[model samples]
Target: MSDEHPEPDGRTRHYGDFYGLSEPAGEGDVTLVIGNCQAESLRIFLDGGGLRTVRTPPIHELVEADLPHLQRWLARTRLLVAQPIRDGYHGMPLGTAELAAVLPGGGRLVRVPVIRFAGLYPAHVIVRPPSDPSLVPPLVEYHDIRTIAEAAGQPLAEDALTPDLVRRVAELSLSELRRREVANDTVVASDLFAAPSFDQMRTLNHPGNPVFAALAARVRERAGVPAFTVDPGRPVLVSVHAPRERAVLDAWSLDGEPTDHWVVGGAPIDSEEVRRAHLAWYAAHPDAVAAALARHADTLRLWRAITG
Candidate 1:
């Protein structure tokens, strides 16, 4: 297919450039899909499950009348799978529930919660010596990798401190950590991309990770669409790095007792294996992980004793 198509308004536009196209689909026969970048990957998975999807501008664009073609497509769509993103990157303020009122007859809706960014905000590391109560509380706060390296007395070369650069380091570190945890076991491959890093403040929806796949499967099942599975495993990163996302489904709009709604504050599906890996890593590295925990515990105890 040609990369660009002309709209009725006399402007040439490329369909699905912002979000990749699975296959050419007819108007009204297509599913209206919207979300962050992760939503784009889900479109790939859905296409793999045999569904035709078309990208529409986000709610903010809709409300502002930015992408005129989207408003027209809204009336023709048979189904919509909406995964609301954070309030940045052309995202909506809350949920995409506002679009429900404008759907065509017999239109079905599926809402998946937004993905949370792991390190969008600054993270502070508190350090207090275990043996010395008199030592000052040493705190190091950083959001990007350059600052992190600087704090560790290993500043990177000036050209090697971009957001993508920092993300590469985080990816390598996480991969190594997971490998050590598995220790020769055939671990499942899981690449989590919907996370905040030095490269970007907010993350789009990412697929391939188990939590993302589980959430997508729930949407498909509820809509009576074909089910698709993703990678079964996920990495247990720093909790602050993988914050719980915002809930997407609007309970008030349900025609009856709701069957399912997007979940927040925790993973939508069971991920005990991730937890098990973490525990195993700590167990195997008692001298490092255990000692670190002990130091933190001691710090907390000291703070409590002084306050009490």
Candidate 2:
């Protein structure tokens, strides 16, 4: 779904960034970052830094009808930097392999790992679509599993939100991340997120600029591209910056300041308001709650252990 939803004014976007209106027209020598939302930000970090990457709409924003447009771009792509994606994504040939197959002969295909870090926000989890609501915002779709448990009459012992608990969970997360084999040259985000002092991740799956810059350096090393010389001068991932509680920062001993309010589409929203929306949303969509509980049983079980 498109990231931007309209506000009452019809002028404000629910979230904001590139609209792809003025993106580079179909051209060869394009380095396309193909994957989820993060890929778009990674592309931003790669540009003007010495790399000549094209900014296409985020893959998720495209649908099956956009295949011809995607194919046209792929036909001209000389260096395709991609993250792993499954077959037939968005009812189109958008997967890593699927996209690589359409690349012109001699087009270079490089894979980047999908980066996810949750140690600072253990209660949050991403519940992939098929069970997700249509046109729902990612920030809203970013269900706080703890809230889900409570709304479902399974209140977590929020006490489980402790440092030692976070540490153990982080270890498991890191181990799992390390095992996911991607490109031999892929730069893993585990290091940046581990005891991060700068709030490396804006959300569980959305990382801060530093992580993208690190990945860009690695990509440039492998792709032999130049580094970004100009900064958009502001955050590229400006859609949703989730709450980073002081307690979480303290527990992780991270150096960043705490953020209680949710930043949606460049606007600050009350944390309580977001929670209320999630609770009401959970009540309205019980199937999602069930799916989340089932899909994340192990993580929930770990919390259950602490609660008991």
Candidate 3:
């Protein structure tokens, strides 16, 4: 649901050099690298230097297989830039429990937290309070999964899914299912909760005779809201926030299923807000973010492998 809050004043705003490239040989210079099921690419730009392309790897090879060379390159670089694998980078926060309950029984859960970066657009940048004093000079910050994971004492697993881990995730899912049931019955149901994205609908297997039992249960727990049953005769359209609308549209254009309609939300997803909230929550409880991200990483890697 839409909640109106006073927008921050312009006077309080400060601008800084949010983007720069660093030389690979400089003492503090490190390459900012990013990769996933999509593709792997690295650029060598000296902090004062211009952009220089160094290497690019196939998306399939990078995520589905090992890239020790890439890891070594990252170890020597100054910064790492990439998206979060677990918890969403945008949209609402659907916790592990909630996601677990919603995931189709036979199908597993996949979380891909992305931070959008496209050719110097102000709106694309994420603004947040610096997590550390060292990160202060820059008004905005970009994080790499590697840096954060190391700091958290929970490094990324080469293999994300293991029997033990899967079982633990399943348990969390069950908890989410119960929680949703409670929320639906008691909490204020908002429009945001009512609108499920196309991706979400696929996860729930839209318009089916019965809604995904676990997902319905979790929705109840988190919002105490009732699940919508898609009208089988009519096409079910999925809607996404504005910021992500273009990317989502492009993706759907390439591979989206033909449906009755696909709708984009009226407002921006404002994922930066979600990230700020998550960071604050993590700051208060350090281990919590680490644990959640670890689970998220594994599932994402697995989803990539299977889908690729």
Candidate 4:
């Protein structure tokens, strides 16, 4: 929103400037939210008076080259809200621990968990091609886990997409998510599984607004800030939405409209089109497919169990 519209190279790098508000009353009132894709929504919810909230490019997207931009923004941050990032991440000093080290005395750093729940779309995953890890995949990163399973020559049974199997996958998804989020600190949106207000997620990683609003309230509690007041009126993370299969809804007893098609940038996409494209891509690049299979091997084993 601050004229840094396009992420440097097409990745969601430059993001989260709300209400055209950039400057704060004091330098100590600056806050920066850093993490993966969900960080943008958190940044927007954290928007209001007092703190000049700015969100850096998603931490996973930042490279050694983007250090200057990250550092420039970090220098102005007094209240840094970040997910758990390890030091030397991406061969640079851009981790949450790394960034927190640069904060001045009395500056605050609030830890926010990276919220992800697969109860909504258990088959979807975000994978990086082994060839060019930076290339934004078609449809903006929603890949069916079954694609990688097939690429690895691991096929599922014809009847494996059952409600029972979906429920097990959802359980495994929750276990892995809690393992990652709880070990850090408070888990944001952990209660979203049966939340009455929202469906929890449009995809595995992209959460609905209520999840973010809850996270903002957590950040405010830790940062000693006033209540968040800026409401975007529309969904903030609406660029790409995964399908709401009937199986997933019944698996979690979720309440929402169901569509087998994906909604990308407000446009519907046939799931078959996505499957064909991904299969073709894998066929063209066998080596990359192998790498992805190997990387997701452990997860695949769990998925395999659910299928068989």
RMSD of 2: 5.8
Better of 1 and 2 by lDDT: 2
Q: Measured by TM-score, how close is model 3 to the native structure?
A: 0.22
Q: For each candidate, give its TM-score against the true structure.
A: 0.39, 0.82, 0.22, 0.81
Candidate 4 structure quality by residue, lDDT tens digits, 1-308:
45667324333323423222243333337788888888878888887757777656777767776677677667767788888988888888988888988887777888888766766676777667667777544654666777767766776565556566666666777777677777877545565565322345777777888788777887887778877566779886777788777776666566777786888888998887888787777777676667767765665666667555
Count of backbone clashes, every candidate in sequence: 5, 7, 23, 1
lDDT values for all models: 0.41, 0.70, 0.31, 0.70
Ten-residue segment with the worst summed lDDT in candidate 1? 245-254
Error of 2 at 186 (Å): 4.3
Clashes of 3: 23
By the TM-score metric, which is better: model 3 or model 4? 4
Which is the winner by TM-score between candidate 1 and candidate 3? Answer: 1
Most lDDT-accurate candidate = 4
Residue pairs with backbone atoms closer than 3 Å in model 2 (clashes): 48-228, 48-229, 49-227, 49-228, 49-229, 50-226, 50-227
- For residues 1-308, write the lDDT of model 3, one tens digit per residue: 33584443332121011111222333333333333322121122112232222233422233312234444444443333332223431233223333334333332222222212111111121223334323321112333233345445555553433333333333333344345435433222121223223333321112111222232333233422233232234222222222223333332233443222222343332444544544554566555444445544643343334324
